[model samples]
Target: MNTKKQILALVAFSSLFISCTKNDIDIVPQNYTIPDTYTFDRNSTTSVDYSGQSSRISMLQEMGDYYKTQATAGNEVNETVLNNMYSNSGNPFSSTDLNTSGKQLKDKTAASTDYFTLLYGGGSTVEQASVRTFFQTQFTQGNNASLGNNAAVGVAGKYLDGTSTRLFAANGLEPQQVVLKGMMGASFMDQIANNYLSVNKLDAGTNVIDNTNKVVEAGKNYTTMEHNWDEAYGYIYGGDIASTNSFKFWSSYINQVNNDTDFNTLKAAIDLAFRKGRAAIVANDYTTRDAQIAIIKEKLALVPAVRAVFYLQEGKAKLITDNGAKAFHALSEGYGFIMSLRYTNKPGTNNPYFTKTEVDTMLNSLISGPNGLWDIDNISPKLDAISAQIATKFGFTVAQAATVN
Candidate 1:
């Protein structure tokens, strides 16, 4: 045989030998095929489902919409209502599906095994409750500010930047931006990188066996392992696949940063990684599956790190121009992005780029003075320093991530 023919024959013989020898797991041969799209089938039926993740994404979308309207309508935000919606209790949503979905953004916020358990002191209910309560408090303060005219030093109210009006707390942080951004990290990013993709969830008890045997869960189309992977994927690419309208939180921000030429292909890279990982799971190619997981975690984590620097840079330039409204809006976003860094997975490790303590200290420096963000004299240097640290950890420079849009 010629050299090419001999090589092909050897590969075929090797695949057959490996397939026959493998007993504990159903390992696909080197020639195993992976689908171009995220679709899998068993017995001629579709086997992918991530409805629960989709519901929670929608819940956050609805919650954000409701919060934004409160100040504009001259209405006081209700803490009880916000809490109910967050916990998915008391039928707070207008959508009947969400009211009955039994899924809330609360259980998932900072709920990842890696970071959540550590930050909450080994899953302490007290710490979790405090975090929820703090969110409600901030929402109330920002919404209540709408009852007055524009905000001033040590005041909470709306501020007009150009033609747009934004509400802020007494210290200059916009509650909407801060809370939403923080959740993007604490809930979505944490769950994706630190929870579902982690071995704690993927390779947990019986996951390998269930995946290898294609053992579908009771009344479910996919196996538990497959479902867990789908849930992670759903958090970002949920809702309508055709429209960006369905994008919220992490989904929205990923696309936002992808617009920059430096990271223009990020969306495609993440999508391919998710698709390949899912396909690898089906093919029983654990090696490929794990490799894809690393890709997904590293790339997805970069979203927040890059944005944290981007927003801080934007806010810093506005501060130099003495534009309070724009500066505060951008910085509020920066605060949330920084808050998210604690949830990021630092490839091949169970730790994040920044610990919760590091993130909190960085956050404190931004809103340090009596007037917090209004303490303009003390803010610029802090923004620069924070941006540098975040960039350094992620192996990127401040100038690269903080590129102007």
Candidate 2:
């Protein structure tokens, strides 16, 4: 985990992210130590105060609760949208589709023209407009503008806000839905990065879908999964990025920017995004692209591969086998998603990991197995502290990260 993210994660899982309401007593803020009932800063998100108990157990419990509640909700929505997207993708043969149709009647058209709201669900139009406006304001004014790279930060802001409703739902504020917002945001950016590096990202985003398919073999539900091109080519032309990796995100940014426009701020945003792209590539200020990529790679190498077991009552079960590459791809894509573009660092321009049918098979196998169900309880808020840990590990948005646990 990066230092900043680590601090946030510690704060989130420490006595700060979760508080005890089962037995409410007079509470006090950590700093004041007074007998106040509400022990938190109003401005601070993920406020936690359970008296003097920095108890790890309590922390885990609280983290679990927060994650499960929000994650389940988000997953329900995510699965629905993904299912709708590939309802007919019994087998997504890119060659066949590209050959048959001039353009696969997909969401690209929608994303390009109506970035305010893709064909997906969960977010309202009013909310999208607000989120778009927020990014616009920030691009021209916020920390990015002050640094002369407001346009660059602008891209991050737009991408962040559009991914999840939870971000803006935070008191109807701009991108305040901290938990799911972060998770979904992480997912989107990760997808972009994976695609940029030519790593797979699709099949992996469906971790919850596997578990939801199990029938308790009783109670259950289900869930796959970018944008940009032209502007991206421009970047490659300008040498901010190679022609290859630059296209996907650059086009996406351009299409997205045009789709979600407030003309007054567009020019500035464009300039800033160009600057941000350069900065990311290792401009004079901040870490260069190479350094950032190295940092991301180091962090990923240290991350533990996901090891899970879904113990179930002995019963009828189905097993399908293939190379574990698919599972690894899914898991790795998720890792990159949560951590940002770091894991995408690859030899040449190719992303080393990504979603594929092989991965889908493994992931489905895991979730469909007995151990899969058990892990639900394991990853449940009552047990594991997945949310905060994921957030800290990946610098994900607080919104979605809070739900992963």
Stretches off by above 4 angstroms in model 1 are 1-26, 117-127, 161-164, 240-246
CA lDDT of each prediction against the hidden true structure? 0.81, 0.26
In model 1, the worst 10-residue window by lDDT is: 118-127
Q: Model 2 — which ten-residue stretch has the worst lDDT?
A: 307-316
For model 2, the superposed segments whose C-alpha errors exceed 4 Å read 1-186, 189-192, 195-291, 294-349, 370-405
Candidate 2 C-alpha lDDT tens digits along 344-367? 223333332322233234334433
Compute the lDDT for candidate 1.
0.81
- Going through the candidates in order, what is the number of backbone clashes in each? 0, 47
TM-score of each: 0.88, 0.22
